[model samples]
Target: MEPHIAFEDISKIYSNHVTTVAVEGVNFQIMPGEFISLVGRSGAGKSTLLKLLIAEERPTQGRVFFEGRDIATLDGSQEISSLRRKIGTVFQDFKLLSNKTVFENVAFAMEVAGKNDEEIAEDVPQVLELVGLSDKINNFPHELSGGEKQRVSIARALVHRPGVLVADEPTGNLDPANTFEIIRLLLKINEIGTTVVLATHNKEVINTLDRRVVSLDKGRLVKDDPRGTFIL
Candidate 1:
């Protein structure tokens, strides 16, 4: 099968008074249904790599391909929207609306994607259950614990049933117990066939994952280990 996601000779440079190289000559391919841990130190280009994969930023050179199509060349809003819909994203920050309840938060994603009220009502509850948030569906962000908030975030990301899930520092704010729970949830998501790209600096998280490790240092691809540990 073709790669679900591929980065070919990728590089990103920001020019200001002085130039900054975010990532350079990075190449990797993510197969369908695989779990990958993107490991690196702070400012090690993890964010830049994800931005390129999602087309949030154009690489200064090279290409990002999703399922055999070059994403950088997609300039139309419809095309971009369609591409993004296939790749769900979860971040360290929950990014939930303060006033929205858990149910509404997850439902909002479907709404934004033009899902009808009927579909939202049907799918939102199921995703909340998947993320083990059925009990907190009516709770507000402030009312939930950090782990619960993150679970809601994961639920929202999965509501789309995207083919790929990109999680950036997802457990950054959680305690050890919560961190482990979140990692377990991510593994469960991966087991069911969503290609997961997890970008984090947590050594223990990477070590315990025993998944594919793609390490970056000073903006360059340094290692690609199939069952790797975090050594950065």
Candidate 2:
């Protein structure tokens, strides 16, 4: 069977007054419905690798493949946008538009992708309910709690039914209870068949996941195992 995602000998380097290598020669494969976590201390290239996967950063040396197509070699702007539609992304800061209501925040994603108003009208409310934010639809980002903000962000990401959701330190700013809640949401998304790639340092959360764990250190892949736990 073909893997859902794979990174082949990927590397990324940043050059300036001081040269830095973010990730080097890292490779891995993810099967369908598998939940994976990438763990490391700061500057371990976890985010760098995610950037490469989505084509935000070109690999300094190698390439990545999604659904068997080489992402680095993909042609056509519209096609690239199509690839992104299948992958959801959530970040630590809950990148919600501060001025918009939760409903508009989620619904606008569909609008940008050219989804019809009728489709957006049906989808946005369903997604907000999925994220447990139905009552808060009228709330602005500033009015919601941190956890609520993240859920709104997630609702937006899932509005198009992304095949995969990559989260980078999504719980970084949350309290312990909120952290668990967000992680639980990610797990729930995985249970629904959206491949989840979470980059985190919370050992307890990783231990609770009981899924594949990929460890990285200074741009190199150090460990990979089924039912893996977080360890550096």
Candidate 3:
């Protein structure tokens, strides 16, 4: 089977007052239906790699391919929109609308994607249920616990029924119990066939996952191990 995503000699360099190489000469492939942990420290290029994959930042050199298409070449707004519909992203900070309720927050994503009311009405509730937030649909982000807020974030990400889920430091703000809950949710998402690329620095989370691990250090690919542990 072909790789679901591939990074070929990827490098991203940022220039301003100072020059910073976020990533350099990185190469890896994510197979379909696989869960891979991207492990690294701060400034280790994990986030830069993700940005390249999503086309948020074009690589300074090399290519990032999603399902065999170079994402860097997706320059049109329509193309990027279509690509986003296929990849769901969850961030450490729950980027929910402060004034919107849980249901509305999830529904907003569909709305932005040009989903009609009927589609949003049907899909929002179903995704909320999938994330175990059925009863809290009316709660605001301020009213929910840290875990509940993150669940809502996950729910929003899944509402698109995306083929790939990219979660960056998803459990960064949660306590141990909530962290495990989030990890379990991610694993469950993976079990159902979504390609999950989880970029996290949590050692315990990495060790416990025991899945494919791609480690980076100082802007370079350090290791790619199947059933890997946290070894940076």
What is model 1's C-alpha RMSD?
A: 1.1
User: How would you encode candidate 1's per-residue C-alpha lDDT over 87-141 as one tens digit per residue?
Assistant: 8888898788899999998997788788999899999999999888899989999
TM-score of every model versus the real structure: 0.96, 0.96, 0.96
TM-score of 2: 0.96
Off by over 4 Å in 2: none
lDDT of each: 0.92, 0.88, 0.92
User: Candidate 2, residues 76-120: lDDT per residue as tens digits?
Assistant: 777777777778888888889888999999987787788998998
The stretch of ten residues in a row with the least summed lDDT in candidate 3 is 47-56
Q: Count the backbone clashes (under 3 Å) in each candidate.
A: 0, 0, 0
lDDT of 3 by residue, 1-232 (tens): 9999999999898999999999999999999999999999999998888888887888999999999998978869889878877898888997888899999999977887889999998999999988889999999999999889999999998887788999999999999999999999999999999999999999999999989999999999999999999999
Q: Model 2, residue 48: what's the lDDT?
A: 90
- In terms of lDDT, model 2 sits at 0.88
| Candidate whose lDDT is highest | 1
Off-target runs (Cα >4 Å) in candidate 1 are: none
Q: How much does each candidate deviate from the true structure in C-alpha RMSD?
A: 1.1, 1.3, 1.2
Evaluated at residue 106, the lDDT of candidate 2 is 91
